[model samples]
Target: MGWLIFVWALTACTENPVDHDIRPPTTLEGEWLVTAINDEPLTTANGQAGSWLGFSAGAEVVRWEPGCAQLMFLYTVDSDDFRADAIRYNVPYDKPIFVPSKFMPPPCAIGWPPRLEEAMEAMSLARKIELTQSGSVLLSGEGRSITVRPR
Candidate 1:
């Protein structure tokens, strides 16, 4: 009986070979550096470049510093694709709503409220973000792409 079971296992293994070279998806749970954006090499008018990006594995939140603006959004994931909605909090603006202040969150924050949503759309359209196993390619519906390496 044991021999019969072993034979079945052997047949299964022979029929479906395993690809041991494949690694799992990268855990996009920590900090990611802004290597480049919109294919322009992440430059800044004020010399404050290459913003930081953060992802919270526990809350499905994405923290982005596109320039000097810190924006937070709740994103929905379908496989490797991500769909993020309106900015939940515009760090520099959201916190200063009631005050007459000229304070900004950080240097990474940039863009006015009028154009911020557009930026969000552009960012999200890169629909899918595949990590280490796939060499971290960002694919957009309009054929635009962004590439990032683990930092």
Candidate 2:
């Protein structure tokens, strides 16, 4: 009788915790190389908007292995948020380098809680990192997606 009660209590106490499948940052810590990026189309009031420059590109690729550079980007994962993580570039450079010639003040900036508060307000609706892949991770909100890959 006591054994049965003990087993029941143990089972009741052992309800699996919330699914935290998004493993910790041990494996993803070091450098990561960006292989590819998918640029989602932008929509305007009229319809699909075209770029003034007439060309579009996604995240930049950097070298991972020494003396042998491929279509990969290497950056240190300074912080990890299953929802909204960040990676500091291995090579230090100014933000201005990313500015487009057509834009006066530069259309946007990197790093979270972006330069605009309004955008964050809109992004608040998206799911906060339910899961992460081995080589890739995603942050989706306000219909915008940011993908990260390993080096």
Candidate 3:
């Protein structure tokens, strides 16, 4: 019996090793920075910029003005791919909402109401986020791509 076990082990070792190097999907779980946020102008005066909000790897959050907040995405793993629920603020207009207000929840006591609520819903139904482990590339909804580096 022992010899049989040894023989099986030797055979297994001679065969190809399992492909443990398979790449995993991108999860944008940690902080991410905003390089750009391009949006067509609804009107000549109300043109919006890149993402309304952006987040750094740690906790540095940035919001674009005259535009939506940059995206500060925190991902949740769902089977093979990763999912995130991020909210974009309406620049300075909604910055006050992020502060502790009389009728707001602890986490969002100071943020804007309509924008935050709308973003929450939009994020849920937003397109899928994809990443390549090797290069840390971020794929946007319209197939737009960005290269990400770990901090």
Candidate 4:
């Protein structure tokens, strides 16, 4: 009876199995300037400003500013996982060209900047967020990737 009681006490004091599936929080709030895509450096062309991304904490939204117009995306971040859905362009209605008319659809309906489209595609496909040693953030998915630096 004494040996049986000792064995039961030891089993009761044993710890449960540890859970290794927990992930670390990914810090991705604030503005970030696009620096590279797929390991290639990005540059401003024809005197045009480069692209950028803005993230607001607890907002679940991300804004992509690519010189001409801003594209807003509905996004979710879970630990190191990131996913974005293309919503719509934040076009200014003050501009007559941007306003939808019977003759012309909205500017977004026509087309978007090539760079902006590329960035948006990459973001939408992004599945992982990695922090670089150089203080840059990398979003990668499949064969595509986007690198950004805090502004």
By lDDT, the better pick of 1 and 3 is 1
What tens-digit string does per-residue lDDT give for candidate 3 at 37-111?
Answer: 221111122554223333343332222121233334454544334344444344344454434334433443234
Off by over 4 Å in 2: 1-20, 24-28, 35-97, 100-127, 130-134
How many clashing pairs does model 4 include? 0
lDDT of 1 by residue, 1-151 (tens): 9999999898665412322354423334555544344443443456675434423332466565453454555666566665655353333644432122445334433444333343345555666555423344343445544444445
Question: Each candidate: how many clashes?
Answer: 9, 7, 18, 0
How would you order the candidates by lDDT, starting with the best?
4, 1, 3, 2
Each candidate: RMSD to true structure?
13.8, 14.0, 15.5, 14.9
| Top candidate (TM-score) | 4
Cα lDDT of model 2 by residue, 1-151, tens digit: 9999998898666322223565534323435332212223323346654211111112322322221211132222223432321123333343322233432333224322212222222223223332244435443455554333443
Off by over 4 Å in 3: 1-26, 38-53, 56-74, 86-102, 105-124, 132-151
**Pairs with steric clashes in candidate 4:** none
* Model 4 spans with C-alpha error above 4 angstroms: 1-25, 46-58, 66-70, 88-114
RMSD of 4: 14.9
